[model samples]
Target: MRHFRISFLVTFILMAVSGWWGYSHGGMPGLINALWITGVLGVMEVSLSFDNAVVNASVLRHWNEFWQKLFLTVGILVAVFGMRLLFPLVIVSVATGLGLVDVWTMATTTPDVYAKHLTDNHAQVAAFGGAFLLLVFLNFLFDDEKELHWLGWAEEKVNALGTESLAVLITMGAVAACVAMGPVEEKYSVLASGIVGIAVYIGVNWISGLLEEGEPDLQDDEEEGAAPAKNGNGDLVKTVARGSIGGFLYLEVLDASFSFDGVIGAFAITNDVVIIMLGLAIGAMFVRSMTVFLVHKGTLDEFVYLEHGAHYAIGILALIMLASVKYHIPEWFTGLSGVAFILVSLWSSLRYRKRHAAQA
Candidate 1:
């Protein structure tokens, strides 16, 4: 409860603002509808992002407090404003060659057309997000160092064959297949976007490795004669940043991939970009709060395989989004499937613990 206090306050304040904005645009009816819609959207985002919270906690628990604060503060801001607001607008701007102001006006005044404009590029967006997510999943699966095998033989084999080149080859093959099957007009865009996604992942990973390598380990830092690293803030913020840089970007990209589906799906419920932004932002805030809660309460350690489940769910999502380029999968399907994976993994974790205890 204490962990969620900030999220609750932010949600209330944003909901009120959304209501006021609705009233200003329409009237009493609009106000009521706005509140209802916002609540629904917020809940929807949270449901779709529950696994995201677990994965985030898995990464966050390894970070220092300073980095965690940075995630809660700067990360949330980026999640809310960066992905929620600017990303869609940027897409619209790029597609239509319209200025930001024009895009905003179109989205607000001519919502149907704005949605069309956005949805029209769904293939490229799906391809990019899907490719990135697929790579993430593959990388996790290919982790030969991972000793825990949820599926026993299958996972062990996959991990054994897992290498960077193999993951890239598989991802490229998936993207190529999509491009080959896609419409002639959209094929180039889809292919290019997917390649860009792959490139971005590689670039970020490389940079993270470099940053991490530059920092000394915790044991080395504790040496009496060692001088601590300094940054613009005159502290070990740099060290923490370097150490967790990979995780920071990974989480951000993961959020963006999730946002690709969410931002587009919001149109099904409402055309008002403002309403969608407010609602999704609230949900994102709560998810972040949940991540913190999971970390502070040691939920991940207790659950054991929760992180595995989340990653597996993420893999399904990546495949679904890739499949969605041609077929239209409902948002409900994505959300429910993720929840199912998480719940099953949780049940498995509990059962495993019981069995192990009995054996002991």
Candidate 2:
């Protein structure tokens, strides 16, 4: 509840604004309808993003207080306004060659046209986002250093083949296959976008690694009387130096990838960009709050398999996004798939805990 206090406050404020916006547009009936739709959209975003919160927590727990505070403050603004509101507009502007003002007009005055333009470019969007998320999942899946096996024999088998470059090779292969099977017109665009996605992932990690080089070695810090913190793999946590620029960039890009599905799917429920932003913003805030809660509570340390479940869900989401390039995947199915993975993983964690306790 303490972690969620600000989230609840923001929700109330947004809902009130939503009501006013609705009333001004259409009166009492509009107010009621606006509240209802906003609630639904908020729930949809939260449901679709539970795995996102878990994954975010996994990264955030390693960060210092200053960076964590920055994440909650500045990062939330980026997630809500930058990703949810402005990102779609930017995409539409680039795709349609419309100026920002004209695009804004189109979004507000002629929402259907705006949505069509945005959805028209879905193939490229899906390709880019899918490629990045695929790499994220693959990197986690093939990490031989990760000792905990969530899926038992299956995980062990995958871990056996783990190597630093394996994830990249697999992702590149996936992109190539998609390009070959895709429409001839979109082949070049898909390939280019997928490559860019991979490049961004590698670049961010490389830069972050460079930044981390300046920090004191984990073993040295432990000997100096700093309490040692071990991660899920039992490796000593490295000190985050001077604001962790790499981790910040990685988190932002990851949020953008997750936002792709929600932003595009919102058009199905309503074409009004204002209502969509308001609703999605509420949901995005809650996701950030959930991330903070998980970090502060040390929930990940307790539930070892939660991170495994989140990465697995991310993998499924990456596949779904790629598949959606050619087929219509229901939004309900997308949200439900993620929830199912999280629930199963949580159950596995609970069982592992009980078994370990009994053995002790």
Best by TM-score: 1
- Return the clash pairs for model 2, or none: none
Clashes of each: 0, 0
- Model 2 over residues 209-234: C-alpha lDDT tens digits? 88788766667776888875547333
| Tens digits of per-residue lDDT for model 1, 1-360 | 999999999999999999999899889999999999999999999999999999899888988788888899999999999998889999999999999999999999999999999999999999999899889889988987777878889899889978988998999999998898788999999999999989988988897887777765656667766675555664565656554777798899889999869989899999999999999999999999999999999988788888889988988998888888899999999999999989988998899899999999
Model 1's alpha-carbon lDDT is: 0.90
Q: Which pairs clash (backbone N, Cα, C closer than 3 Å) in model 1?
A: none
If scored against the real structure, what TM-score would every candidate get?
0.96, 0.93
What lDDT score goes with residue 276 in model 2? 92
Model 2 segments more than 4 A misplaced: 216-243
